[model samples]
Target: MNMLEVFVSSLEEFQPDLVVLSGLHMMEGQTKEMRQKRLLEAVASISDIPMGVPVHLELASMTDPELMSAIIHQQVFPLVNSVGLNEQELLFLTQAASGPHASLASWNGVPDVGVVSDIVFWILKEHGRTPGKASDLTRIHFHTLAYHLLVTVDGYWANQVAAVAAGARVAGTQACATQTIDASRVFLKAPLEFATSKMEEASTVSLNPHEPVSEWHRDGVTFHYTPVLVCKDPLRTVGLGDAISAEGLLYSEIYPH
Candidate 1:
């Protein structure tokens, strides 16, 4: 059987609450047509369960605007309920979509959170409004060294906050994973007090003092975000985004805050 058949068979057997599609560029397809065909089949097989696609652009795809566009418009935007992008991926998407042209220095230095938020919101809105789209996205996640931002509709505050916390923990675990050789030790620890301090700072300064999590409202959606502990020098970076996206989705489904 082909890749799609295997994926479909697994989906049937597992019946998971959420499905994540990542590293499509790393799949066995030598050509775009083959990859997209498999992607369509996998997406079609998923019925009601929420699907997420993280923009894990490889080096080649990152430089190839055409390939990036096809991946976003043809494969990802149409199928996923939520999409996650790291800092670099977020900047690339914003520039590719002709939304903004801010420098990474600006993002990392002074870090205009409002500008970043606006760009992300615009991307999500555009994707949802696209005509003939296969599915409507319910959430957009932006993970950075400094923080994790979740954009979703109103009344999902609890789920969104839970997702933020889960993502933070996953990120911390990934950092720990880099330091050790054992996979079992990855999720064993995290700095709770550090995360709490950052959260308190973000909530006290950027958002309303009454709310536990930092949030902003725009275009009928609420942005729930929390600061994450950044590894000054991570030993491993691969799959960090995937870890964050997966844990975030899982927690949103299971805990709901």
Candidate 2:
């Protein structure tokens, strides 16, 4: 807290619209005592942000169970308005909280859409803002090799389909290091026809190749899903999550004025 006091004290002058925090994993190197102390500071720093300024927490690969537990159980998850994560980070979060689909060690290939939907639904219902909850979380931008999912409360976010497609498009362009996409060099990994919806058993969502974004609603939340154009031979695998999240955020329109 002391180290960042100077920056934390200056939020009013800058008055930024969005705040993204990505390096909490950098604190994992210290001893448990020191790490716990820093986690406290982190909570204080994030909680001090001015009201209505959306904060997005970008998570990375973290293996320490204790550190993961602290983040999930503390004010960190409650304070942030949005979160961006890959499959590994998403699974780690569910595992930490012992939420839905927590028993699987890992996925063999691209995770099933129904399963992913179920877990994402669980996250919002339990931890996110809803009718009675006091938490700030209202959106989650989840990405994987095959597809991207943007799940948010209806009123807080607009432009759902465009935001999701932007994320998918950037995944290919960034991975291939090209501004223009070459069709032959990329392939679709998500199902072209349809995907099962676990939110309601025996139901599925259809994907249109011409317009790939699939949308559905359940339990007062809306879902947007889009297939990714995966690079056949990728030059870079690192930082793709950040690219996807940033692209989606750029297209997303916040409803609040």
Candidate 3:
């Protein structure tokens, strides 16, 4: 059996509470057609568990609007419960939302919280309205260097504050892992006040049109936003978003309403 078959079989046997999918860009094949087929099959095989897909778009994928659209709209968006994207991917999606020829000048630099928030909601709205979308996601997650944002219907997940804390802890773990620090140091030494301060800092920045900084209600959804545990000098930059996404999903499962 191929990788897809093996993965599906394992899911059936183990019955995991959550599954995080990534590395679509790493799938190997001589031709694009071959890889696309595998991706579609893999997406089809996942049905039972709550799945999250991070938009870890490679440089090539970022440059190619057509490929990016196909991967998101055709394969990933339709299969996952939640979607995670970093700042760059979020910008690209914003551009795509505008149209094929939309200018990227507005999103070129470091965007403010309000700008990013608007783009995220636009993407979510587009996904919901897209005809023939095979799946409807319950949550939209956006991770940036400084903070993370979660958008979901009010009452869909209990304890939004705790969920953000869990994600921050996971991000802390990633930073520790990069520094070769003992993982135990995180739980033993990190103070709760530090995380709280970060959240406070993130909340100081007002949303566009003067909305609250951290959490707000709009269109039946409550937005949960929190600052990340940032590492000053990091050994690695890759896979950070994946770690954050996994931790958030696992935390929600363990402490669901």
- List the candidates' TM-scores in order: 0.69, 0.94, 0.70
Cα RMSD (Å) per model? 7.4, 1.7, 7.6
> Candidate 3 has what TM-score?
0.70
lDDT of 2 by residue, 168-253 (tens): 99999989988977798899888765555644663577777887898888778888999999999999888999999999999988
lDDT of 1 by residue, 51-90 (tens): 4321122222254445555656764564555677776666
Clashes by residue pair, model 3: none
**Residue pairs with clashing backbones, model 1:** none
Candidate 1 stretches greater than 4 Å from native:
27-61, 102-111, 129-134, 155-158, 177-212, 254-257
Whole-model lDDT, model 2 = 0.85
Error in Å for residue 2 of model 2: 5.7
Please provide, for model 3 over 1-257, each residue's C-alpha lDDT reduced to its tens digit, 9 standing for 90 to 100: 16656776777577666555665655533257876776677666654343432111222125444456666677566555567777777766656556322365544443456566566665555664233644455577677666677776444456556666577666766776643334444332211221212112333333332321267655665677766556655555577777777667665632243
Better of 2 and 3 by TM-score: 2
Quantify all predictions' global Cα lDDT against the true fold: 0.57, 0.85, 0.56
Task: Report the poorest 10 consecutive residues by lDDT, candidate 1.
Answer: 190-199
| Ten contiguous residues with the weakest lDDT in model 2 | 193-202
* lDDT score of residue 128 within candidate 2: 89
State the displacement of the C-alpha of residue 33, model 1, in Å, after optimal TM-score superposition. 5.8
